[model samples]
Target: MAMSRNLTLLFYVTLLLIVLTTNQAESLSSQLSQPQSQSGHSMYGATQGSLNPQACGPRCTMRCSATAYKKPCLFFCNKCCAKCLCVPPGTFGNKQLCPCYNNWKTKRGGPKCP
Candidate 1:
């Protein structure tokens, strides 16, 4: 009887964890889908509806703007943007804004995206 009770408790705990994880994942998905502003205007001054391949230049430029190293920063930022189709807002941090851009890793196991 004790063993059965333990098993039931473990099962409930696992199910609770799964439900919590699913809710968190859904919340994150919604946040990632929505733009920073109600108007869909990004911090980079472009509307989400207007973003395109050609617009990567300005976005990447803005992302790499405050970096001490300009050339390499722009290079990698643009490359990541080209492939990921998005750039995290601001000069640094806020990587969670772009999952593809943020999840990329370098050969050395460091962050590949700026």
Candidate 2:
């Protein structure tokens, strides 16, 4: 009889532990899936990201390295990356990162970047 009681107690303890661990894992995954930012607009603005240079690097490089137009290319690319929070792939032509940066037009209706 004493052995049966100990077994029942151990079973309940194991069940409680499983329940607690499952709940904790679900909570952690939910937190990870959402993006977080401090500033209300511009930096992240529900579309772009904050001042994450690492995230902006590839996009900026792809854009700025494509041509002899160095100063303006980097300037505009960085500005767009800051606002859009992404850059496309190659060094010549790709707008996959941020469509806002891609579809954006110049005053004369020309492509803005090199």
lDDT of each: 0.78, 0.64
Once superposed on the true structure, which residue ranges of model 1 sit more than 4 Å away at CA? 1-33, 41-50
- Residue-pair clashes per candidate: 0, 0
Q: Give the least accurate 10-residue stretch of model 2, judged by summed lDDT.
A: 39-48
Score every model by TM-score. Answer: 0.61, 0.47
lDDT, candidate 1, 64-109, per-residue tens: 8888998999999888877877777788988876777878999999
- Model 2 residue 87 CA deviation in Å: 0.8
lDDT of 2 by residue, 1-114 (tens): 999999999999999999999999998876555455464222222233433666665557656775888778888877777766655556655563446767777899976644
Give the winner by TM-score: 1
Model 2 TM-score on a 0 to 1 scale = 0.47
Clashing pairs in 2: none
